[model samples]
Target chain A: MATGNSEVVNNAKALSIEVDKMSKLRVIHYINQFYAGIGGEEKADIKPEIREGFVGPGMALNTAFKDEAEIVATVICGDSYFNENIDEVKAEIIEMIKPYNADIFVAGPAFNAGRYGVACGAMCKEVQEVLDMPAVTAMYEENPGADMYKKFVYTVATGNSAATMRKAVPALSQLVLKLAKNEVIGTPEEDGYLARGIRKNIFEEKIGAERAVEMLVKKLKGEAFVTEYPMPAFDKVVPGKAIKDLSKARIALVTSGGVVPKGNPDRIASSSAQNYGRYDISTVHDLTSETYETAHGGYDPVYCNADSDRVLPVDILREKEKAGEIGELYKYFYTTTGNGTSVKNSLAFAREFTKELIADGVDAVILTST
Target chain B: MVKGIEESGIPVVHICTVVPISLTVGANRIVPAIAIPHPLGDPNLSKAEEYKVRKRIVDKALHALTVEVTEQTVFEN
Candidate 1:
């Protein structure tokens, strides 16, 4: 009886251990040809291939994750191949990763290697977007791909070269664990990751006014003070190919000046608008005082209300169309109140409406803002 | 919003009173407005004068859209 009772106790302990092992988070690591033990740049054209278990820096990541997670597989591709055939390679790599059913995807601590950095960023982005999996990577701050993809992927900042691999691996692994376990991630300074440029609201012990006063005092004392909201580095777009001829162009009117029909029927907020309004002005040639007004609160409404065409010049655009200076006006106009609106919200609004503008074959836009 | 439209491969001319702000925001093509309160026209001017002012600004914006620029550019009225 005593022997039987001991056996039963041992079985229960074994079962608990098995349960714990099963719960270890599954991870898949991605690396370029060099790290995959393939030949150097010569092998960079090699196609993507998957291998079971850890490879290269992934071994360090495995150690960092320790018993909390296990790298189930490694997906290796050459930098040149990945970049040169981005769409195809991404699809193939995603397929390879899918079978693993990984909880997290980790790409290279790419360092300053531009091609490798791009590969890492691209893979991580694809995994996050397509597979709906948590993806993380490491790269130097100046890597061009870092600027392009950091907003979409969580990237840990590493030294300019692989000499920092020792440091990068642990930081990358820690972030992976936090994401896999759904743990709260701290600020970029605390988490050793690049800022994703996403603004999140958090409650504070003191009001904003008090914080501002404290910061002012510190500044007056010539002490260093950090701003709560750092200004964004705006993206500079190279101008698109110029319209060959204005007479043949179909121009569309868009505005952030908050000019809407007199009734403000869309109820777009006078400030910090959550959405944009699309109004059809196909039949209207001029914006008269009784027909249109300014919905914007930032600027005085008097002038714009007197002649809404001053804000959105449907009147002049019509004259241009009549004079054959331009092909025609697009039948509709898009308007939103830009004052105090978050960039994210603004982008979302544009993304949604631009599709329709594109589909309608609009050639150019005249975006007026106060 | 201007950036988004430009990024979609459509050329955009941002007409604003604040040229510096427009430049800082990375607008590729810009036309300066007369003032913040009345971007396209001076309200104090007579109706016909205001119409000419508005016409000139619109013409500049139209010209801006056609001119090929590789970088941020502000068109002089």
Candidate 2:
């Protein structure tokens, strides 16, 4: 529940999209605390709130809903608060949503503000995954969360500011009804959302390599063909100063080779991995077939499964640790399968676990790939 | 993973069989290895020989961590 002391922001502007008839289907909307009439950055640490009925931009959304559905509840969280304390906030929001039993969830047309966009994306993705319900969010095509969640959720494309709310409402409302009614979802062009880059498997006239070259030709000519993976602008990394002493530095092993304790208890994918696993190796001196195996599918797993040390070199590093050639090996190793995994997911996994590495005082890392 | 860890100011050496792929993905320090399936081990050899091969590759990766490279550079093994 938003406090009465909250001050309304830019959401009071008139939007043209409207409908007179009340709808039956219930919808839950998500917006940042600022849009809930909470103050700006200075007050961005406010926690989650469930306000009964529409607030701010949810008004325009309600107009769009018209005869199909109505905004039953609005969930608001500060952008910073949502991003900084995601795990806790996510669980809290899920609990808040359970009582409403809303048919569909809609997050912000977040525009170009990065944190809000990511929050909207994260909320929509979580709703779909954990609640097993349809969810949608709108944001600028270039929003950081666009590439990260576009494949996992439906995201309507919007302009770079709240001014586009009018145009955004109809498309978002339309998607809400479509999802609520269990209607067929269309291509991005037809539905007014960003492309998900999900390729359908259909027998083509040409082989893949030949078709790839053909796509290259079409791309050069600016002809019509579905676009392929676009490389994101990679961060320019400043090289860390060389480790000054081998005997004293804490060395850690991280891998994209996907070596795990036998049976891979986490069920991490053998290819196109969606998650990473951290395993404790405090007592592990040698990797054996009975104790470890490879989950990577892009290469022969036999060698790695026979001796997981092949991919991780744990046996050698263990020896190095004992001989005082290097400092102690970090107790946990992070691993994932690199096969067909998206760069966006890879970047996310790294961003998450690297924090743990730094917090644990690991001085250096050795990353291996198959 | 290599570049991400490095960006956080922890030096990382990427050990992989494909040096070119490592270069393309922006690992500052790289170490070449044996093959895709067995980056540091050779099943064709005896246990002692295979261990020596693994140790050599691991030693090079550790060495790569201590070398200051101005750009993406691979330390061959």
Candidate 3:
């Protein structure tokens, strides 16, 4: 074991890895059996739980993520997400993450430990796929999950054991920040994101059409040309179900996909929002500066914050409500930030929100997605 | 949201311009609009066109509320 040196916190030594300091990013972290401060082997069968702030290498991760973002939430689960009751665990953990506002997600600094690596790889892939978000996890090059899910997510190769935790976090953090900025990342060799067994364009100097044409011409002539764009293919979410009826059902409008007051007075973060509050607009025609405000951070606040009713369509729905075209429109509208939102968290919110609507006898929903 | 509401045992009439998402999330009834960002009306268009689009889609969504369907159905606008 890499002993003696482990006792002291070496934040400076940990962050000494060179990186593009210009990029600013926000990040969410995921952890496993030991690092969650959970006892390993003894606690290998641990279920998922939510925690705020840093745990284990999370301190190093925070420093690594400095100027980039705060590590908003640290989700901890065991290797058992696959070995034990996988489905329930995934669902439960996903539900746990719905409320936070985040720009990027990171899982494991899973060193060389095989099971831990697999766990990290799987979790990162699941997050990236289901949430339509960016995710990264680190594992030893030899971990089996590395082979399985590395192609799907950003899985970095690492040395064996916790001794490498310092090295792992910075490598993963750099890639994660680049992801948040929507900047092009190279293959595993260049950017440290697990190689997807495919190469993509990562332009060094120029961008857009002119560069694209130059690269294309080089490729056509069988000459070497570094591409300017390397976009990862996203898995399409299977569409939402079709509604049965419209005119007769009492339809209500709901948006937590961040419909807010124009000024964003509540100052909600786009990806990892912690606060969720419903504004009272019972007496107002449309949400105004004094009447209602936004806590959502998914978009440019000016438009939605100035007129939240536009995003929620409260006025329009109210107009429908007055006509008695169908039935009563629920007065309270739910709100939350959708940027960098995780599937686990969103579903949990959905289940809770469903209960509220049910009790109120709300018949239907007309949700707008940004 | 409509699909989520319906999953909780209430009926819903999902209004979306994105036909694919509406169909898959299991919304019981759906009404197609012009585009994604503005499902009812295009903000850039003339008021007449906006109203024309909104009136047509909104009418379909409202009408869908009255009808019963065994499976997912889209209201043609």
Candidate number with the higher lDDT (1 or 2): 1
Clashes of each: 0, 0, 49
C-alpha local distance difference test of each model: 0.85, 0.83, 0.62
Provide the lowest-lDDT 10-residue window in model 1 chain A: A338-347
**Residue range A1-370, candidate 2, lDDT tens digits:** 1543232322222122222323378899999977888866545558999999999999998988776788899999987577657779988999999898889999998875556777888899999989987899998876666756788889999986677888888898898899988898887889999988775665768888998999999989999987455665566688888988999989889999999999998989976689999999999999999999988764657789889999998899899999999998999999998865666788789889999999998989999987
| lDDT tens digits by residue: candidate 1, B1-77 | 77777788988899986564576556899998876556787878998998899999999999998899999889995
The CAPRI-style docking tier of model 1 reads acceptable
Could you report the DockQ of all the candidates, in the order they appear? 0.26, 0.28, 0.11
Q: Which stretches of candidate 2 lie over 4 Å from their true place?
A: A1-234
Best-to-worst order by DockQ is 2, 1, 3
For each of the candidates, what fraction of the native contacts does it recover? Answer: 0.68, 0.72, 0.19
Query: What tens-digit string does per-residue lDDT give for candidate 2 at B1-77?
Result: 67768889999999886564576567899988776678889899999999999999889988988888888888874
Docking class of predicted structure 2:
acceptable
**Candidate 3 Cα RMSD after full superposition onto the native fold (Å):** 19.8
Tell me what TM-score chain A of model 2 achieves.
0.54
TM-score of 1: 0.53
> What ranking emerges by lDDT with the best candidate at the front?
1, 2, 3
Off by over 4 Å in 1: A1-20, A235-370, B1-67, B70-77
